[model samples]
Target: MRLAAKANLGEGTISDFENGYRMPNPRKLAAMRRAFEGAGVVFATRGPTLTQPRWR
Candidate 1:
């Protein structure tokens, strides 16, 4: 819920994406990525990595 709020997307949109039913538009996807980054996630070439302890 927090991630969805931070990404400015409805929970349904994120749930759909997680279930592999749909993808958010590029703008929404970018917002999601930014939200993840703000939460201390690091996107790496190999895969996403956590750079620090989670805040929430």
Candidate 2:
């Protein structure tokens, strides 16, 4: 997926993180977070949810 490409990681690696099969290092996690934020994703601390930002 685009996230994998942007994170310079393999699709399988992203899948592993999503499926709870593995955990990424702090640096990788930060990279992924930045990528997602750039794509308009806003992370919420309530239950640690992912949501699109509301632009008004």
lDDT of each: 0.89, 0.77
TM of each candidate vs. truth: 0.89, 0.68
Q: Which tens-of-lDDT digit does each residue in 1-56 have in candidate 1?
A: 38899888899999999999997899999999999998889998999998995666
What tens digits encode model 2's per-residue C-alpha lDDT throughout 1-56? 47898777778888999999999999889988887776667777763444664333
Off by over 4 Å in 2: 47-56
**Which one wins on TM-score?**
1
Off by over 4 Å in 1: none
lDDT at 5, model 1: 92
